[model samples]
Target: MNRFDRFLAIDWSGAMGERQRGIQIAYLDIEAGTGPVLMRLPDAKNWGRVVIKNLLMKLARADRRTLVGLDFCFSVPWPEEGPLPEGEAPLDRVEELWDLVENICSGEAHYYAGPAIRSMESAFAPYILCDRYRGDEFRFDRFRETESQLSPKPASIYHCMGAKQIGPGSFAGMRMFHALRAVNDHRIAIWPFDPIEDANVVLCEMYPSLFYQMAGLKRAYDHETIQNTLAYFHSGSPPRMSIQDEADAVISVAALRALAADPTLFSDPRRVAAAQREGWIFGLAPS
Candidate 1:
């Protein structure tokens, strides 16, 4: 694994709109003692996926060794028959799935607001159906290392309903991945799939809850909660943050910083195959 000069965390949103309040970006330089700082979006409202993609490409073009953690699943559990349309050969690799989803789900916010995914489920064999699966019956990617450990358990990428669900975010994120790969003329690497050491920018899936637990903090979004979490990362001193910002952004950056400090968290010999196909969360330990 390469040592990154900068660590960035994106708290992504699945909510519909040209802009969303749930989206936020935070970063910490290896040398900045003040700790993580949230990047300001223009208009101080919400960030559109296009704006986010441009900022990332700008960073890659600058040749900065950066590791970006986006809070969404990279891929869902591989269905028994694969995600390809009928008669098409099984996807030879995970990048194929990214291309497949992007090709099918492009121009549709949150992957056409669920219907696109439903269509996908219908077209593929051994369907990972979104409307039908519930609870334990829902399939999870083998690389979802945090699901068993996190509370309420992580929902399947197919479960697209109710509060605290990750389905919509994962859908939107895969579309963003497609856009990001195309925007820079193909200069980025989704980790474990592409060679991290060779890519200009490394992108990984991240879960804020994992970091929040490691920091010994509750999942609260208040001023005091955010301040206390910042203190954990800043040698017991709180970093300044705007109350208007969401707590996940702050927690994500801190979690990313922690992952950067410890190399072992990124290296798991046993899950290499799973990581390439299903995608692993950055800091998850192998079962």
Candidate 2:
């Protein structure tokens, strides 16, 4: 197997921000024989798809493996088209999605969601814990949470949680849970989610001084600060590791994993068809 040269991470969100209210895209480039580099596009609603496609194009153009990862629900409840008949109300398609979730949690599939992480009081609660299975074995644990209510979701490529509640308990809570599960199970591999190495893969190339400036700053290393930094960039705000920087780190890790798995998924016609059959969302395409 060849080492992926191009890796892209995404910190996705549905809400709009102060400057731009749309998806956030962060890119990291790891050359076969070189170090890591970072690239980014300001905010836009469809930024997610755009960045991925552009990155792939660059990789393809250079004949490099284009790896990409995102922290979003590629599989969602099918949208309800129109209103129902007289007395009938709308139904939640979550149950259908849940069937998929069950398979993931049971380890029948490759990935699933993480349990919600709230306060310590909430984290230890039973209902909050999710079911996990490895082969015939199973374990349960509470969800993980971030400071901000709005943040990117975590992913699980290997092990995932079977949720008792619908819609990823919370954005950060369940997604981070799933990502951790994937890492622990070896379904996915990633650099440590710390600042020094993984967080600034291209720090030496871009914003070198910022990296050193943030060193030893407690807020610089805070979980909330990370997510906030991602949001800032998405909103077209100036760089501030206090919030958005950390979020990008999380997104970068996830993106690296996605790209490593199938850099050609977006380009290979056969892989696209197979992915479609597997129920992956394919709306993201380069313009």
Candidate 3:
């Protein structure tokens, strides 16, 4: 297995407007002794998707072996009922899904305000409902198999509304994935879809909540909690953090550090089958 030299954790957002405050980027160098540091956009309050895409392209050009963790559902649950429309092929592969989402949801964010997803005359239409989001009614990917067992179960990627909802973020994330793939010409290796191989940049789906649980910490944007979590990951003593800081990013980078130390995390036997189609979270145990 190729060891990553750098780990990046991105806390994503799908809200309207030119910029989103919910977006946060954090990274750590395996050779660095200190904890992860937050990245700031120049003269901007928040990061736009384009800016992030450019940054990643630069990283790839630099020949850096980086593992990027974006906090969003990489793909939705495959339709369980029947075959899709004749031309609308099943999303059995991640690249195929990315192309589909980019083609359908181009030029707008939040999937062009849900109507685009609702109007999608394809097999995935049922799962992206703006209202009435239920995961049990629909089966998610293999990575989400343990979702119900965990506290604060994750909302379905189709659920686009409400504070705890994840649908909007996922829709926006798919758009980003599409853009990144175009810029890189499909050179980026998205885990499960393509083997790790000798790819310079590897992208994976991430759930910050799982990292918090692993670190034995509660969900709060406080200095002490961030410090404690960093301490748990051997990031040395945590640096001072503000309540306004994006604490999830810090915790996520620390979690990536832990994951990088263990090769078994990436070599799970179950990943061979389910991950190729359904997608999987980076550090989640097999269900």
Q: Model 1, range 1-287, lDDT digits (tens) per residue?
A: 43887888888877677677778888777776656777886677777666777778887886667889898888766545665445666786766776777766665763433434556443332334455443333345432444544565666666566666676677678777777766654457787566666566788888877776666877777766666766666533334555433567767777677666676666672355656677777777766
Estimate the TM-score of every prediction.
0.81, 0.31, 0.83
Ranking by lDDT: 3, 1, 2
Model 3 C-alpha lDDT per residue in residues 1-287, reported as the tens digit of each score: 43888988888877765577788888888777677888887695788666777777777776668889998877765435322333455555666777776776676653332433455443456544455443233334322443444566777665555687776667677777777777764447777566675777888888888877777877777767777777777776544455333788878888887786677666672354545566678887665
User: How much is 62 displaced in model 1, in angstroms?
Assistant: 1.2
Which lDDT tens digits does candidate 2 get at residues 1-287? 53554555444432222122223445444433222223444442343332333343444345444444544433321223311122333434322233334433343122222322222222222232234323221123211211011122223221234422322422321233343434333223222121121121211001111222223222244555444443432322222333453344443443343333443523442243222212232212222
Best by TM-score: 3
In model 1, the Cα lDDT at residue 172 comes to 74
TM-score-superior candidate, 1 or 3: 3
The prediction achieving the highest lDDT against the true structure is 3
A best-first ranking of the candidates according to their TM-score comes to 3, 1, 2
**How does candidate 2 fare on TM-score?**
0.31
Off by over 4 Å in 3: 79-89, 109-125, 128-152, 184-187, 237-245, 269-272
